[model samples]
Target chain A: MVRPAMSKEGQRPDPESDADHRAFANAAWSIPSYLLSGMAVYGGLGWLLDRWLGTSALLPIGVVVGLALALYLVYHRYGR
Target chain B: MSARQLLAAEGGNEFQAPGTEIFEWGPLWHGAPSWLTKPTLIVALSVIIVCGFFWAAFSKPKLVPRGVQNVGEVGYLFVRDQLARPLIGKDGDKWMPFLMSTFFFILVMNLMGVVPVMQLPAPSHIAFAIVPAAVVYVLMIFLSIKEQGLVGYFRNMMFPPGLPAWLYVILSPIELLSNIILRPFTHAVRLFANMFAGHLIIAFFATVAYWFLFEKLTPLGASLGLLGFVMTIIMTAFEIFVQALQAFIFTLLAASYIGGALHPDH
Candidate 1:
């Protein structure tokens, strides 16, 4: 990903070289927070559903679904 | 606990763990001047230390770079090379003052924990962390608006290029939530939690040693106290590493946020 991006851009003191490193750092800091916010938002929704429906099933399912969504979101934005 | 039992056997008081009360500082004066809390004092001290150090080091610039100038240059270069330049690129040098002050201010604040009498890191308090994080957050927003127009900024942020049209509704909120909301929250919390927990652990072990050795002494409790003392020694070293790392991470994230704001395309 980085190599292609660098070569694609014309050489200007290799600012592109730094992009990948910066991106890696940005990903490191944001990824966990993304996972957490995803879980909290969707898991809260699931918990509300469990309370309304009078069943304990949806919470775990909601949390799992949220995790998957978050993972997808992360990969789409940064990993690729 | 085991030490407390031994102390009890030796007709001494039980060991007690330190509590949150340790963090609850009392007002320093009659009126207390509203803003004169321990954390606030530490924050002011940190600013002074950072400014004073740089002033001493760089006030009289020598072409040859001797003594304090050498140290100042090293710190300046480290921030510019490692953090600012990599992310901000062409105009990176222009932002050096903000980035340098931020990095050093945070580093000094975090180091206050290890400084003898001043045992608390100002950033351990949420407000201290929030002040810097909020400043960065506001700067990011202001810069984003300045760099990209209001409509354009939101458009660029909420809708990245190349995503399918149908996926916009599903994905845009996540992007908004992660960038606008969670970014600052995590930024503040990361610094606060590390410093808070580090201070708590050190206080805990120090209290243990205090309880076993000075308050309730016994043959068996002495060994326990020795263990606690040793653990305190080890944890202090570990806390220093965490302190510096958290400072670096905080600054790195600040630079990252500024970079994102300045150039949304990336």
Candidate 2:
């Protein structure tokens, strides 16, 4: 299912490869965890920053940045 | 038993909620038998059942399969085709025994919850699920370290091959947190939560049925009891599918972890 998303590059298409299926399964399970961990680590950092600096805005900002980072990480590794 | 008594004690006025006391247990007997608890017994029974089934099936290899072998072959094929081959891809055979035992043991353990006269699922008790998750985590760590030297494993895991160097500082923590900490936690909790909630629902309905129909019998109450009884039956069937599925997923993830350790994405 994910194979069709491969963009038009010079790369040879091996849609039926075992490695492709394995990588697909790995990514399927993995992406959610990446998002969660990104949220957790950055959100915690943001909370700490709020506590230390007496500012309330960092928490939401941190979560957004964390989410973008996580999405970018997934794209760099799997989607691209 | 206590729910009925408590309701009766209330002069049959209001329905008393079934409490968490349902999970509590005293040892089966005094002295050395103190170790004999429902969860403990269920786990042991599940282990024996798994081993016994496989032993019977493959005790003597026949040219043409018989009863036990036929059942065994079906299970073996399921683990191989569905889990090992698709998830692990190459060098998957070596992990078959671990995956096979894990799938069957968990399946049997989960099924025990629905079985009459022994309705407690062992894995629902978080500890049962944690042990396997820990073992798989240890195996994953070990395999990764062994296959790719210690520093290399850590490098590959945290810093995926082609990412810019500066991003590693920001992202390595995410990778570490996800792989090292969260993976095992989720691995154990997924199976545990599913079984726990399934058992809780089944128990709740069963208690309702027993409490309303047998103890406090009334036309209105009997209808609720019948609903409870019907839900109990339906949930039990649903629980069977859930049980098998959870087992399959647990095993599949285990294989995926090992495979990832063996061959990281280049």
Candidate 3:
């Protein structure tokens, strides 16, 4: 039954509380950190695909997709 | 050429023209006397033009402000009251002029995207954003170090005394890292990325509109061309708001950074 604290003026309190700050920090970190990790994964996968397919053009596509996934994940959790 | 046709033919490349990258800095950089490209010239010109407008506007202040004077005053007062004073308080008394000038300077540059013929935002350049960001970064570090002695400042920033030991270990590094690194990076990147993305989007739609109207083969292409033009107009309005908002945000963040420096306790 923990409620997010509100300022006496009824504004949403600033993100300074240990819990609030932790939530924000974790959320922000997870987004960019995971996105970069996702990019690396896709980059590796794309390279493998290019080597197999002999097209050599899927690398950029994979990198972009990886980045997209990372951003999507970040966006999903940022507001909550 | 009419401005629109000229812009379209040149692909809105503001520098000398397409296919040439050489630039002449003249007295600005005496060493190089190269042929300047259109974008660079346009951007530099926009800066001069914007600065000139305010200079002229404020140079002769009337007892009752009129025309450009009124507009300039409004813009100036907006930054002074809403941004610099709120964050910096009494300390802002001296710095308000700097903050106000910087805010409007950036706003004018950002608004250039909406201006005809000069559709480029100067702050779209990393160097442009970096200049203001660097100012804030230096001010933040200076104030922090100055007000609290070097050790005291670092200790205050990294180790707030009230926090529990276990929490301190985890939170301190993050706080320190954010204050030291992420804040400035994000501060600059936020404006840079926003304007970059916005300009690119505008370029994409403009290209689509042009290609459809002039190069494509079908009636549908004509309709889509018009649609693109309409969207461009809509986006331009949004970009105006964004440009001003960004200018404000940059100033606010700068002031906040200064505030943090002045009063590290908060």
Clashes (N, CA, C under 3 Å) per candidate: 0, 0, 9
User: If candidate 3 were superposed on the true structure by all CA atoms, what would the RMSD be?
Assistant: 10.4
Over B44-69, each residue of candidate 1 has an lDDT whose tens digit, in order, gives 89988898998898888766777887
iRMS, all models: 8.2, 9.4, 13.7
Once fitted onto the true fold, the runs of candidate 3 whose alpha carbons sit more than 4 angstroms away are: A1-80, B1-43
Question: Model-by-model lDDT, in order?
Answer: 0.81, 0.83, 0.65
Evaluate every candidate with DockQ and list the scores.
0.27, 0.28, 0.04
Best-performing candidate as measured by DockQ: 2
Off by over 4 Å in 2: A1-16, B1-12, B30-33
Q: Per-residue lDDT of B1-266 in model 3, one digit per residue for the tens?
A: 32244346666332222121111113334454454544466557766877887888888777677888777766766665565555655455568777867787788778877788767776666667887898889888988899999999889766756546785554454445556766677778888888777776676567557666765536867887889889888888889989989988888777766766775654
Worst 10 residues of 2 chain B by lDDT: B1-10
TM-score of structure candidate 1:
0.89
True contacts kept of 2: 0.54
List the TM-score for candidate 2's chain B.
0.93
In model 1, which runs have C-alpha deviations exceeding 4 angstroms?
A: A1-12, A51-55, B1-12, B29-34
Query: Which pairs of residues collide in model 2?
Result: none
